[model samples]
Target chain A: MALADARAICPDLATRPADLVREATTLAALRRWAGRYSPMVARDGPDGLMADITGVAHLFGGEAELRADLHARLARAGMAAQSAVAGTFGGAHALARHGGGIIPDGALADRLGPLPVAALRIDHDTAEALGRLGLRRIGDLIPRARAPLARRFGPGLVGRLDQALGYRPEPVAPEAEPPHFGVRLSLPDPVGLQSDVMAGLARLLERLCEKLGRHHAGARRLRLELDRVDHAGVQVEIGLAGAMRDPARIAALFEKGVEEVDAGFGIEAMRLVATVTEPLAPAQIGPARAAPQDGMDDLITRLGNRLGFETIQRLAPAESLIPERSFQVLAAAWSRAAPADRPGGPPRPVMIFPPEPVMAAPGHPPARFRWRRMALTTLRATGPERIAPEWWLDDPAWRSGLRDYWRIETREGPRLWLFHTPQAPAWSAQGVFA
Target chain B: MRCERAGSGALQLAPTRVHEAEGFGRHAFALFQSVCHDGPVVWVGPAHAPERLLLAGLPQGVGERLHIVRAGGVDLLWAVEEALRAAPVGLVVAELETALSLTAGRRLQLAAEAGGTTGLVLIRQGAGSNAAQTRWHCAPRPGAGADSTLHQWSLIKNKRGTLGDWTLHWDGTSAAFHLVAETGERRGPAPPPL
Candidate 1:
């Protein structure tokens, strides 16, 4: 517990401060190396390793041979490891700490029946309580009634025994490895030129595309990371509408962003990662479709990076008679739905703004009105098209009751779309027919 | 403001120093309507700029052919350059502060050559030695309250090395431009006045 008390027993004992972060990093690295044995490898508690080798045992000759190889490799890496294989997770865990080997199917109960009940992984209080009941070995609790045993010792005691005896399923969840479509390049000497950065980025893209080709994948979001010697790293990202792999097009899209990167001192290395990817099927480029698809994808990608991915939006019509509710904005890259054209109705305004009140001369269609900042003189008036609020819908903007829309051409040579609400003694400019 | 398929390239139009009042975006839509091609035109300006009203003074179909991109005030130039390189659209109208370096102008010219996209930079401030084929200083002469559009334009820089100045008028109902010669010599529908 305390270093001072331990040193009192042996005055010359040595000690060092614990580095938990470093230990955790080393464990994670060990987990990656263990993936060579099987894809499903997990860290068991703080010091153990768990690898699932179901149908993969044949790849390394057999289960015992794979375990031997793993132990030898770990020993060479300065780590002493212990492992076991069994039909159940609890059986393997218990046997690995007590007696290590491959236990055949349906033989876990017989092999583990003689071990102490402590090997069931119960705590000290439960073990002492079990000892008070004169149950010293795992076999001592096997022939007892389950309901009575559960009532006295609790369900956890019974559950652990069932799991160790292969009666319950306790599947081990392995720590998953990070999925990355990334490539890196390190220069012999640090270079700060944009052309050099471009060259390194081009190399990284080639390697990344090769890896993507092997996996039949395409990147939707790419990250360019440039690490400078002065410890300042610049990262830029580009998004695409569809899957892309063309190196020239991808590099061209990053031109503006790359120029803005501040390579303080010099950049030593560059990394390109396809952070977001999707499965792309191999398809033959038919004559009519290839050119249009490529061109469209290029255009959308450039616009998305230049402005913003969210700023480029497509308008889709909705099933509503209300002016504002008649359309919705969808992301241009994500939407394929086009607005359906409605015929035989007056054209909607090209632009709509917040209602700016204008003083209307009290008459059936005011001849001239003052819109606060400017006095608009009406040259012609066309409509009394009435739009009523949807009663079933609770909209805050529609609380003004009802509106009558009119298309008028002002004497100032501008076409205007104006609306009048019966509740207020004024008219408001809604849209422009410009 | 009309499209010319000849030795001409992308032209940069800026309002003179005396006419900088609301000049950056005041006439962007006007110049855009005069020379736009068949494809959509991208209008790049500050985030605070009133972009929706830029189409109010143009014809009916011109409003539908526009795609607006809101950029940060400083990144407006880069956005315009990127749009030009995309080559899908024919015209790129960018409203930005006029503080461009010579290299920035040359880069825009090179990008336009690669994509064949026309670049129109609308700025309130003036600069010297432009890479644009033609530089025009524009000031609007509204017809009091009528639709008879009159604009005085000075040709500051011409690629062929010739310079001139003129005033042009447009018929609103007919959507046609008429050159108003100083000595009453030129007449009829004028060339585009972008």
Candidate 2:
């Protein structure tokens, strides 16, 4: 409509340019507010929201009561909204857009019989084509043969009809519901005190732990987000040394980080999310003495977060024959102590140094060898234990091919491990058997 | 003298700058083996760490509990301090190439106290000065014991209050140490393996 025509309808017609920022903020805040209604709430389009209320309606005293309470909450917030709950997303969406109310389960056809073909939510052109064919009501399409209608109007119309009638499956992809383990609280009044923040954390932890327990999982890392009254957000992340489901232990680990939370003008809201989680089951059998395991984990976690866990580690034994690859270093917090070395294997050097080439005098045991600027006479020599390279792996050290290793005692009293690879036709000092 | 209580004191394992390659690893690892039975270990070193050297002297499971951190000298102190706070950490060892200031040493001590974890600072080449609980000088006496690395360890500085000398014979079989002499005295090629 022209500005003059719009002005004629309402002489004092006023307008302002659209603010994308304000619209985005409103949508974000709306999504946040919709959490209490269900964990899975998503903005459907520019002016609509889809909720997977599945098993949550009974909490507010059945479907009708929940629907009434939701409408009342919207009215109080001064945001007008129309909602419909159906067994399927298709049914709910169609009912909501075309004057929605409570649609009983198993009555999608009966309840939508009188509604126009537009209720199927097809494109306007498809609806107009169906209208021209005298199939104006959804009930008209439901009773007729599906194949004929599909051939005539195409699958778009058939799909819309099937979806609305609850034949096709519809799954709502909620906007990443803040990691399923998250819980948020909107304060009755903005609180700035440390005690208030702690209390808020307590409440959030309780709910989060309950959910975590139901899922049989433990949080390995947590992020506490404080939404201040001034619109500033403070996020403090705390990592766990091990998976933990105990609320008290998790709370204790987070005490230091939370103390650093800048309240700003006061926190109007708070959100706690378990960013990393792992499957954890309660101890089936208690330890004979609990003194060691629990306390040690706490200490490791506290120190790891305070300093950095990567700085702490345990040597994990790797299943390999190569000296350098025999053991793997793992984060101390996440790994267990490696088992004792198996006996009867060739005596391997405790310390495996980087390999260096050797210049040797030609002989069965190489009578003399020079390495690291020192020439040593091999007075005593042992076996030529052959170690072949793993065919599946590409190791630079092993690129020289098969090796014949010999344990030799140098004139200088250094017990050394030297290997000769025929592929390279060269000898190299592999380790210092100190 | 090793195996200090976790989180109670910060000790120094100083290998004379002159002979780092000769004995630094032997005694540092022996010290690590001494206390590792109590808990886990975190060994923080500089980039291009010779980690395999540190664990090689100790026996299988004993060395398996060591966690390694490779950072530069600038971040060494921070890594050591943080390691001191890791509760289950029985020991935190840093292979430092530079000298540690008194303030840095004091901060490490305070952190150890807070975390109740012990700090073992391994200096490749350090001056004879520190407020650490103890300072040791380790040298490899390769022919000193029967097939064992007889490390001639002298108590160069004993802040725990005793400057005693001892020869720690590292038994490769058990991955443990046996004090050979209290006088810290040794003869050339002392007796063949028993």
Candidate 3:
């Protein structure tokens, strides 16, 4: 129920916003921890877990004992959990939510009969429709003719019934853990110099690169952790423009970050981990391709490391009538250079500012106007290029309606691109034609 | 630095040296893009500068080879020098609203020489004494014909040759500059039809 509706019935109601992402993360962590019970454990739904304890039940003595142990352990950990074991995953899932317990072998049908038809896992609408026809319990649908029920209620209604009764297979597929790529080094005596730390990093990189090479993957981001003797540990992260594996190249990229590590007394240990990686197949280096464009890539990477990668950009003309939408500024680090194409359009301004309102007289081209604290008089004007907004797109800037643009040369010496919207009848100084 | 003569022998920019151009309405960019036809150009500007090149207004294929870098006040010169030292780059255009010192100018010039790249320093306000090879003062002529574009270019400082001023007509489609004639300051009626 909504908090507002509930609070009217009972004056004070406590509520908190739901975080689905955090709940899913917690469930996934629990699924990993449940690996000790059975290797084939999978998340059943939002609030439950399902495990295929096929041959592993003997290890815990019996199915009932295993379920009790699992439930007790979760309760000890401050989590209230209900568990049910059965021959089929659907049977166990239904029992866990509705009537949880151990279902004896070949007795799935008898045990699931007392539960409501909603326990069959059909949607609420289908269950409500079935209830109106006097089939309110799972037992009511068991004896019905398959053909007519299938036609009226659809295949999903019958499919969920068969799966719960062990008449169809519902296998539990477990989630696999990803392999971690990290290497650590410990020194007997603490080292303080930056060179010593770099030496340690080099050794770690050699090991990490070898692992990456075996997997045919390359590192896109790396983290180096320095464990200082007296102070808290320091972590330096390196972001790469492209996936790289070479130790020499990776070390060169780390040159700027190495100085940021402060070894309070001395650094006892260092660890390097490849946090983000991408598949990169080995390519043969030949003399023919060595001198071509490596210098440009190296320059981009070097500059991107100092300044941010996004600040370095290349502009490409886009196909749009809107002046601002006619060009795109792409990051040089990620996007390949776009080929130059001859664009068909009128001359655009060299510099464009976000549209700012201007005070203008009531005239065709606005003979007099005040903009950016300067009073200006138009000496020459040329245009009424009418450009309509794209109706399909909702743009706040174009809310006022169609615009008629003009290139007005001011007596103050700067040519301005001004626009007058007829629908709302307002003037805005958009850009300067320098 | 090697100076290549233009077809009209009017305005030429040398590769591997710093040339300072004053004013924003000048033909320095028009002349630079016309001369350096090969290698990539890197444009470095301060993060606060409001002006930017209109790619649609530039000639065909020039926007593809151009790279723009925006840096803060302190890193502005550093970014310029770094771009000047890249061999794959043909030219570096540094747009400055602040002043450039003689030492900083010499350092940028040396980097350009080492990388065999040209550097154009565009100063909008203060054009202090610098170690650049040439200093230019250009402005759009007032009474040019409505159709034809004209700009007055003054080569105020030249380390290797004599200084002179000329009136140049710009062909928009061809992206070429033709020398019209040497002129003294006379502002009245529009120039005669081409």
Candidate 4:
């Protein structure tokens, strides 16, 4: 409806532009607060709340008592809220908006039949169409054959009807809160020295590790935030290849990072947070199995902290016929070290890249060619190893068609892997066997 | 040049020492040395020369225990030193396109000594000297037959053993190096001009 029409209908109406993002944020905060009622509270549309209070309603004496307490609390918080309790989420959603009440298990259909067709959660168009057909009430459509209603309005109409009548399951999925693991320390006397910062960091780590120990979790990534007296502050973040919780080892890892953080006038506060964590089982010093942890993991973690973890990789074989797709590069931090199965078949070049164009005169294998600004004479040629592209995969690089690979030994001291695409009629160098 | 088959004793790159190889086949020789050890191998590739080995082309044993590390220009040496110091690995191979200082080389050597790991540095360009235990210059010998490829290796500087040169043949099928003898005109101080 236009604003002018709404104002003509009710000249005293209040109006404000809708801020959807802010509204969503406020609703999300409200949902978090509603967690006090039940762990399974979920947002019911934009203005209502759906809470599965099956076993929890007894704690508040009864469903009516719980609703009274909720209404009292919401009123005290200066927000008007409407809520409905039913056996089904659809039933609850519809009733909360149309008529508020509690419908027992078997009485759901009896209570929902009196509501308008719009209460079935169908769109306004479907409701208006149902009204034209004299099926304005949910009870009016309940007795009709489902196939006709489905054929007339599409499957969504029947699906929503079934969901509302408890014939279909409509479970409420609540959003979970993220875990928080952080510790902070405020200094009485501002200190700027690196040693002083290290001391403060150690204290924060001690408390943070205790918290992690209780949860049987270990930090995989951590950040240290320093609040300077005069400057904005600085943050040092480090990612470990594996989970760790030891204070000494963690402190050692932060040595370089702490040294680089400038302490502007002086340090006022320090906070250390584990932004990422993983489950880690406690280890007992057992006989024979107590050989010190593998040094490779430590090495990887230490290096990963400085040079991003993704930069360290291992090669693993992938089942593919394409030359470039034959091997997979996996992050060494997360991937288990597996022995590579020696690739079978013809010899492959030691190094390979995307085929770079080469200047060559017409020939099966060019007798002489220019590549990378170097003119070289071909001493001999070895192969016409034909490799066809995988038909199922539409790779842009392989669109050049059937490739005839050749091992050409140049007059200079280098062997190059050159290919000729028959379909495209061009020659390119893809690799070198150094 | 006339070359004879080297003596029976294999080329021994002692563990816990830094060895340098330069020239065309430097990377290949470094990989060859890496597989000889027992544990993991870390290949530190500098950003400037981002050369990588085709896994499918590598020999069966080469890919199983290899970990490739890509580091920036300045971090290249630092990563190598860190890998050397953490020495549980069998070998650390660093490809150096930029010049390496004597101090950096000595630090790498000390780290290798402390960790008991062998360090092989593949000098791609420049002819800078370092405190490496041995320095090798290698190149491919042209006209190698269809079945086998030849790489000429000259040990220019050997701190522990005598300096020498040899030609080794790489058999495609077996994936092993065999010392071969070459008979040709000598180039260094051999025959007087007629």
Q: Pick the candidate with the highest lDDT.
A: 4
lDDT of 1 by residue, B1-194 (tens): 44343424232232110111123223533443334354556666666643344233334344444555666755677777776776566566666666556787778777777766776666654653356655666554534434334555566666655666666664322234566756633687887889
DockQ of each: 0.10, 0.26, 0.42, 0.54
- Cα lDDT for residue A212, model 3? 90
Q: Which residue pairs clash in candidate 3?
A: none
Order the candidates by lDDT, highest first. 4, 3, 2, 1
Put down candidate 3 lDDT per residue, A1-434, tens digits, no spaces. Answer: 87888889988667779999999999988998999998988877787788888899989988878888888889999998777888888788888888589999989888988889998889999999998999998989898888899999899988999898888888998666665789999999999998998998999999999999888898988999998888579898887777778887788778779887778899999999999998989868766543324556666777888898998988987878887888888888677777766565566666677788999987888999999888888878879899999999999989999999998877665577899999999999888663
TM-score of each: 0.59, 0.61, 0.73, 0.70
Worst 10 residues of 2 chain B by lDDT: B13-22
DockQ order of candidates, top first: 4, 3, 2, 1
DockQ-superior candidate, 2 or 3: 3
In model 2, residue pairs whose N, Cα or C atoms come closer than 3 Å (at least 3 residues apart or on different chains), thus clashing, are A299-B87, A303-B85, A303-B86, A313-B67, A350-B56, B6-B116, B7-B116, B7-B117, B7-B118
* Model 4 Cα lDDT, one tens digit per residue, B1-194: 11112222445577799989998778667766765666789999975453568887775577867888989877888889888888578889998877778998899999999988889998855554568898989777665577347777788888887888878875332335677765543778757779
TM-score of 2: 0.61
Root-mean-square deviation per candidate? 11.6, 11.4, 7.2, 8.2
lDDT of 1 by residue, A1-434 (tens): 68889999999998889898888888888888888887887887676777777789889998889878887888988887677888887778878888688888888878877778888888889999989988988889888889998998899999999988878877768955655799889888999898989888888888888788777888999999988998788898999878888787788878878899999999998889899999887667666544544665677677787667666555555667777766665666776634244323665555566676778777657788876466767776778899999999999877887999987766654456788888754578877552
Q: After superposition, how far is residue A96 of candidate 3 from its true place, in Å?
A: 1.5
User: What lDDT is obtained when candidate 2 is compared to the true structure?
Assistant: 0.71
Clashing pairs in 1: B1-B192, B1-B193, B1-B194, B2-B192, B2-B193, B177-B190
